[model samples]
Target: MTTVAAPTRRRGLFATLGDIYHERTNFNFIGRSRIWLGVSSLMVAISIGALLLIGLNLGIDFEGGTQWEFSVASGNPSSTQVREALKDTPARDARILTLSNGGVRVQSSELKTADRELVTQALSNYSKVDASAISIVSVGPTWGEQVSQKALIALLFFFILISVYLTFRFEWKMALASIIAVVHDIFITIGVYALTGFEVTPATVVAILTILGFSLYDTVVVFDKIKENQSTLGREKGDSYSSMVNRSMNQVLMRSLNTSFIALLPVISLLVVGSGILGAVTLRDFSLALFVGLLVGAYSSIFVATPILVILKEREPRFRALRDRSGPSVSAVAVESVVLDEENVMPAATPNPNDQRVTPRARQSRRGKRR
Candidate 1:
């Protein structure tokens, strides 16, 4: 008898990257879902704790204040000079920050017209800038309260509308799961903002609202795939809800990542150059909230949204029957292969999450195209 060599298959240098981009890679997302779920739960817990205890730092737009802005040829005021200017005055609690436009921003609790004029005059004289260079504006506590109320109302309405839409468009369970994911994103984003002591302005509110849409788009991409996969589900044999969900996720994973990356590119530029370098306080406040929201939004759609949906789906009578009848597929078995070294291909043991002995998605269409 002659000994024969077994031909081994080799993965190319860019095989992994190509697979991911082309929706051909197999990742055990549903198999490892519990880990991801636990991670998300822990984050939400921390965020909620921070929100209840620390609270958000509201901006002048939300809290009543008198704001004065002006330019000085000699540059902005130092903290020492700002302190000296407010010394022995009711406006001693004022905040002074430098603007990118070589101007100074002065803010304090509500001041009477006389006091406001006096404060402006003092700053003008100290900076030796023209009197006309100083501009002052007042905001009432009542108005701030109103804005806060309106924001809350808008948020409530948005939630209601989204829930109804998701319920009808997909299924009730998907709707509920999506809500949980959206909530997760919001809580984390708000918590990060609160912890950073970033001022919550109207611009920040707008950014947060915008995040809901982005999160929804990412989530819908996955859910739509899940629904499509569900159609072909019963037609084929050996398909479990877990495996189907995992397959759907893999199909849309790369598209989600690409979309998030493209969206973040401009937002990052705005934060770094427009806000940090240019010192545009408005842009800073706006960009900070958006940056956090965009990042968390992207995260929740995959890790937070799909897992919840799968768990919910597994509860249905139809899926339950299919899961009980089916076993793992050949593709599911091959999915176990993972590269160990540049040239060494290793077959990983099936994770088998259930104590009773269980297993794992086929690669699908790229970028969520219609079947």
Candidate 2:
């Protein structure tokens, strides 16, 4: 009797690349959701702890203080010079900052008119400038409170709009998942601000809102893909809901990463070149928030949002029935015969055709056309 060879084939050089970069990846994301959720839980917990303990470092705009700005033409003005300039005045011990245009910004508690004039003269004399050259602005606590209130209102309005839109556009489950992911990004970003002690300015508030939009956009894209795949590919392939979601995620993973990476380049330039090298303090506040938010937004769109959707959708009666009746399709367990390799490849249990619950929409349409 002659021994027969079992079928085996070598993967092409581009196969792995195609699998990873072209949405053919089989990364078990839905299967390993517990790990992702666990990691996110830890991050959220730490963020909550930081918020409760350390708290955010609000900027002068938020805290309500007097601001003095003046430029120096001759020498390189340091924070030390600004401190010394205020040393003799009631505004001494103020927070000193270097502006992008070689100016100094000093912020301190509200000062009396006489004290303000005295401080102006001190800064003018220290910098060898006229008293008229120094400019002062004062903010009351009421203004800061108003800003806080407006920011809160904007955030609330944003949440409401997102919830309503997602609920109608897809389903309540998708809306819930998107909202949870946004909330996750917000807590993490705020926690980072608190932990790093970065001053929370109005620009920071704007950046936070911008990131929420970015996060939502990414999540909606993924959700849309999942919805498309569920109706078409999932029905044709007899894939369970979780498997279908995983496929959809892999398909869009590269696009999400590329979009995020391209977006980060400009924000990174603002952070490093504009802020660090050019010494624009405001750019640092804005770019840092954008950078962190973009990264978290991308991650939540993939790992957080998709997994949560799978969990929610799998509980539906239709998806649950599909999952319970699941077995490897004949196409998934294809076997081939090869002359070079003698290996026995054990295929998975084949699915019974009668047990398949989902009929492809195309097939249904064809049947209706025939009828």
Candidate 3:
């Protein structure tokens, strides 16, 4: 004849923060693998669609062009001034850049010999420099193709090396998952660039490679922890592989966040301050790629890589058997117990063969064994 109120669950940022601080977070990352994987699939599909339809905005460096560099001897002229100076010439639609060293660089489609001379004269007069002082370089499409080929070769070599190293270090499954995550990061980053029409320069390529390394580092850290826990805690306690992976993820979640935060700060600074405020075109190209790549890299390492690893691992007979034996409730309780163990707010759980919480089927089996 008595009614009791159920305890309310914590919600919102502060509660989540408290849970994280107290190491009482029991996030079911592995259990919700479908959601994470579905989101990634959507992103990848959109990225591929964009690539097929819109394509990347290849810069003058990749597309080949005529470039002119000159420093003003009189006064600093803004990009508008440089543009106006070229208005009467054949290079009217040229891309003008303000260099950090108080110089201006102009790029346009390859011009004829007479047109090039005329443009040089125009830039020289605008900057009050001798015609000879203005430097001009022309790149052809062949050169751009060569650059593309070299970059692709380097990327392929990097992938091969990573696959071999990771196979030796962990297993082929981890390597495959990590590589897939890295590719996911790349596609997303490239899709952003294509959608935004950002120029794909050499600097962007360099930043993409750098972020891939950072993504790999994060994935390796997580995989190492999972391996450690699987061999020690998981084996001793007979926990499922996915459960061990989930625990390992919770353990390293904070560390991953801190690393990503630190990595993003300088990149954001470079993008916002260096490029946006200071108007450095090269920095803009470099930092933009780094910013996008780092964010997606962090995401793929956590959501994409580990989930894929769990899926691949659960296919193995040993892990599949463990998953089958644990069942849903046992797995849930096991994850909660991990939180309790870390928080130390509750007594350590010990297995009891006759525990009432055991399923009726398990109890029946025990009774049959006793008979």
The per-prediction CA RMSD against the true structure, in angstroms, equals 14.2, 14.1, 10.2
Worst 10-residue lDDT window, candidate 1: 336-345
What's the distance in Å from true for residue 123, model 3? 5.7
Q: Summarize candidate 2's per-residue lDDT along 115-217 as a digit string, tens digits.
A: 9899888898888888898889998888988999999999999999999999999999999999999999999999999999888999999999999999999
Order of candidates by lDDT, top first? 3, 2, 1
Indicate which candidate wins on TM-score: 1
Candidate 2 error regions (>4 Å): 1-18, 72-81, 84-88, 99-102, 232-238, 327-371
Model 2 weakest lDDT span, ten residues long: 333-342
Model with the higher TM-score, candidate 1 or 2: 1
Best-performing candidate as measured by lDDT: 3
Worst 10 residues of 3 by lDDT: 337-346
Per-residue lDDT of 192 in model 2? 96
Query: TM-score for all predictions?
Result: 0.83, 0.78, 0.78
List lDDT for all candidates, in order: 0.81, 0.83, 0.85
